[model samples]
Target: MPATAPSASSAALPTLLRLRDETFDPANPGAYNLYLLASPGRLCLAVADVERRKFVALEEYQLTTGGVPALAEQHDFLSLRGWNAVRLAVTGRAFTLLPSPLFRAGDELAALRLHHTPTPTETVRHTTHPGLELVNVFAADAALADWLTATYGATGRMLHHTSALLAGIVNQRGAASPRRLYLNPGPQELTLVVLGQHLEYCNVFACTTAEDVVYYTILVMQELGLDPEQDEVTVWGELMPDSAVFSLLRTYIRNVRFGFRPGNVQYSYRLNDVFEYRYFDLLSLHFA
Candidate 1:
C-alpha cells in the first residue's frame, strides 16, 4: 500500500470500496476533477467538485492484467475524458526528493539513482512541491505514463505517491506544532514522514515483521534526535488499536496514535462508514 495500491485492470476485478455523495454529478464530468492513484498492488480513483471543495466520490479497485485501456471500457464516469483536471500519481516506484534550491532540471535521473535503480521499462519524471520547498523525482511505469498523456493529450499534474502523502501531512501539521511524525503502513511496507522545523525525513521501508516496524521507527527517531517518549506519532491505516503494529508502537514509542482523514476538504456521508484512516492516500489527492 502507496498500499495507494493496496489488482486488476480487469473488469471482473472486485470493487473493494465505492462511496459516492448524492451531490456527485456523474452526468457532468467537466465540473469535477478526477484523481487516479496506481501502484502494483491496486488502483484507486477519487472525484472532487471543484467549486464546492468537497470530495463527492471515492472508489478503490484491484489492478492485475493491464492499465489505461480499461478506462475506455468502464461503464462508469471513469470512462469519460471531460474532467476539469486529472491528476495521476503512481506509487510503489523509485523516488527521491531533493530541495528545490539544490535541484537542477536535467538531473532528475541522477537524483533518483542515488536512492533507487529503475527498471528498463520505467521513465523518470519530476514534480515541484513549492509548499514544501522540495522537488519529487520518481520513476513511473513508462507505458502507463505514455498512455495517459496520449489519451488525455495534455500535460497535467503527475507526481510521486509520496507527494500526496507529504501534502496531506504538511497540511495537517500547523505552525505551533513544530515537530511531528506520521506513518502510513501497508501489508509489507511503511511510509514514514517526520517534520521538524520543516520536513526532516520521508521514506518508505520494506518490512516483513513487527520488529521491522519498530526498528525503522526507532532508527528514524534516533537519527533525528527525536524522543520516542515525547514526540507524537500519528498513523493512517486500517490497523486496529490493539493490532500488532500499534501495540508495538505504543509499547516502545509511548506516544503513538492513529491518524484521521485530512481536514482540508469535505467528505460525503457515504464515506463516513469507511474508516477515516483507510483510503488516506487516495483522499489526500484532494490536496494534490
Candidate 2:
C-alpha cells in the first residue's frame, strides 16, 4: 500500500499555531493577519498583528561573530507566502533555516534559539511551498540602520509613537478602512500606497520630498480617472510630520483636499502600532 499521507488538518494546525504564536492576538478573538521581521545582525525578531495593529512580541539575541553570519545566510529562504510565520536560526554570524514546526512551540523557544545559547547550525528540512515567492528585499544603509536604532529602538516607544499619530487621522476622516494599499521603497525613497477598491490606478512616489508626493498623488488620481480637484487625497508617513515637506506638497498639489497620516512607515525589523513598518505587511497591504 502507498504510504499514508499526513492529515491535512494536522499539518494545517501547526501552520495556524505558527501564525498565532508569531503574529495573532489571543486577547482579540479572530485576529489572524500578522507581519514578522527577523534581523540576524541584531538577533532581533519583531512580530506584529495587522488586525489588532500591535506588536505581540519581541526578543533580542546575543550571538558572537560565529553566529551572526549563520543567521544572515537564511535570507535566501525568506519568502512572502509564509506571511508572518517564519523560523530563524543563527550560529555566530552564519544564518540557517529552522523547521516550521519549531515556530509552533511558541516564541520562547524561537527566542532561545535566536538569542540565548549558540546551537549548531542545522539545515532546515522541509519542502518549500510551491506558492512561495520572494517579494521585497533590500540592503539597509549603515547610516539609516544607525538612525533607526537611535530613534526607535526602545521597547514600545516606536509603536506608541506610531499608533497615536495614525489613530488620529484614520479616526478623524472615518475613511472606509482603506480599501486598497501599496508600499514601495527605493534606495533613497519610501512610498506608502492607498488605493481604491478596483485598483484601476495607483499612487507611487517618494516620501522624502514634497514634490514627489504631489507628483505621485496626481499621477494616481489621474490614472484612477478621478480629478484631483474634486477628490480627497490623504498622505501618510514619517515625512508628514515635517511641516516644511507637508507645506510644499500641499502648495504644489492645488485644489485637491489633502490630509496627513502620521507615523514611522519604514519596512524594518520592528513593529509599530501607529506607523506601518513590516516589509511583508506593506506588500500584503498593497496586494490585499
Candidate 3:
C-alpha cells in the first residue's frame, strides 16, 4: 500500500545533526551533539542524565526498499514482529526515509520497516533541527542556465550542497526565495551566494587556488555594496580544522583588509553554539 501523509497529530518532526569526523569514530567517548530535524511523531523519553549530558531513549525503526517482512528476511538481526529504538545512522536515498507512526513505547527490540512507492526522482537532503520543513530544488527544465536564472538571478551560481540547503531552509522559514541559482562544473568552480530578496548587489567569483580567496572576498563585498577594504564579512561552513580550503578562504579575505570571522552556521531552532547545525529541528516544529 502507498504510504499516506500522517495527520497533524501524528506527524513526525525533522531532526538535524552536525557530525564531526571525530564523532563518527568509535574511540571517542563523548556523546555527539545532535539537533532534532523536523518534528517526529513521539517525544524523547529520558532514561538517564549525567554531567549535564542527556541519555534519552526513543523508539526507532529502519525502513528499507521492500515491505517489512521482506526487509526482515534480508537482514537476519532485525526482529520482524516487534519495535526497537536502536542508535542508527541512515545513509543513501533521503526520500526513502519518510516519516511514519509505526513505532511505539513498550514494543520489543525488533526491527520494523516501511517503503515508499517507486517514482522517477532526484534526492536532495538538507539536515536541520528536527521539525523544520524539507524542501527539494531541482532544475525545472534540466538546463543549468535555466535553473540558475530562474532560482537565483543572472550570474548567480550554486557550488555546494550546503548553499542550496540554506536557501531552502530560509524560504521554508518564510524568508524570500531566490529567482535563480547557478552551478558550474569545472576546475575553476564558482558558487554564487545570493540573498533571495532584492538586495543591493550580487556576489560572484571563482576559487581556483588559495590566492583566489581575495578575488572571491572582493566579489562578496561588491555584491553587498560594502567597501571590501573597510567592512567585514562573516563566513561559516564545515571544513577540516587545518584544511587548505579553509586556510585559502581565510587568508584571501584577511589580505583584502576585510574583517573576517569564523563560525558555524545553524539552520534550526535548537541551535546552541559551535557546530554548523544544518538539518530541521524536529522537537519543536512541524511540517504542513
> Which candidate's lDDT is highest?
1
User: lDDT per residue, candidate 3, 1-288, as tens digits?
Assistant: 111222242233221222122112222223222211111121111111123333221112233333222332432222211111211111112222112243233321121112222223322222222332322222111232233334334322222232233333343433444332221111243333333343222222445564565465556556556553444343333234365655665554442211111122222222333333212222111121
Residue pairs with clashing backbones, model 1: 3-6, 7-62, 7-63, 7-64, 8-62, 8-63, 8-64, 9-64
* Residue-by-residue lDDT tens digits, candidate 1, 125-230: 9989899899999999888887677656573467887998988877777777768888888657788898877888999888887789889999998998889989
Q: What is the lDDT of residue 211 in candidate 1?
A: 84
Candidate 2 local lDDT, 62-138, one digit each (tens): 33453433333332211222333332311122212233444333343343345334334322111221122111111
Instruction: Give each model a TM-score.
Output: 0.90, 0.34, 0.29
**Candidate 3 ranges beyond 4 A from true positions:** 1-137, 140-190, 194-208, 212-214, 252-288
Better of 1 and 3 by lDDT: 1
Q: Which candidate wins on TM-score?
A: 1
Report how far off residue 174 is in candidate 3 (Å): 14
Off by over 4 Å in 1: 1-12
**Candidate 1 to truth, TM:** 0.90
